[model samples]
Target: MIRNEIKIKSEEGELFDKKQIALAIRNSTFEDDLKCSLLEDGILDKCQGCSLKYICNGIDQVVDSYMEKTTEIVNNFNFD
Candidate 1:
């Protein structure tokens, strides 16, 4: 799917940062463990004040879960 489609499919449904999520996914390995650790361990703390934080938080209902949801979005991403 294209970036717009991905954004629409996301839980935030247009309220989040599709580009940031895409970038995070591209930067990550998408491994379950790593994703979990990133969220659980403050690895994404840099995103704390990001404008997309609400969308990211909406993805998992936890602001820190940005990496986890990003991985999920990337893993399930489809190209058309």
Candidate 2:
């Protein structure tokens, strides 16, 4: 799924492209999947009990997957 067309940009500059991100998402292992699991799944929920949950936007595993390596060029990118 991950081709070689996407453009990856970091704060400094573009780091990767679309295809690369798709590859990473597809190659995710069980543990890797678990790391970003949602609160209902257990991962984020634990954060809720922890002190940092308040600030943590909670892992958006879905978005993590949906966007995976390719982020659509929204109207604005807030890198803050």
Candidate 3:
């Protein structure tokens, strides 16, 4: 049988509906907060010589661009 409702377990052991988790993540400040924390902890020094250092350096911008495009695509999707 196919299941219509899907659930995910959090690190805290709480069960949440997949849609609920998706919505929560979509509206969260996790990326910005993580960037702030990394900057505060001097992530640049830690990421020295890493191949993805350049991408990680501007992750906020990259995520913003990706989200913008994703939102546009979702908004333009044909749900009919």
Writing each residue's lDDT as its tens digit, candidate 1 over 1-80 gives 43633344445555666676655555444433223445568766676666666765565444346545554433565699
State TM-scores per candidate.
Answer: 0.23, 0.25, 0.27
Superposed model 3: Cα runs more than 4 Å off: 1-32, 36-38, 42-52, 72-80
Ranking by TM-score: 3, 2, 1
lDDT of each: 0.52, 0.54, 0.56
Off by over 4 Å in 2: 1-15, 29-80
User: Clashing pairs in model 2?
Assistant: 3-19, 6-17, 6-18, 8-16, 39-45
Ranking by lDDT: 3, 2, 1
Candidate 3 residue pairs in backbone clash: none
User: After best superposition, candidate 2 residue 23: deviation in angstroms?
Assistant: 0.1
- The sequence of per-residue lDDT tens digits that candidate 3 reaches over residues 1-80 is 54334565579875758665444445554443333445467765566676776866566565566577676433555678
Worst 10 residues of 3 by lDDT: 28-37
Task: Mark the regions of model 1 whose C-alpha exceeds 4 Å error after superposition.
Answer: 1-14, 30-33, 37-80
Best by lDDT: 3
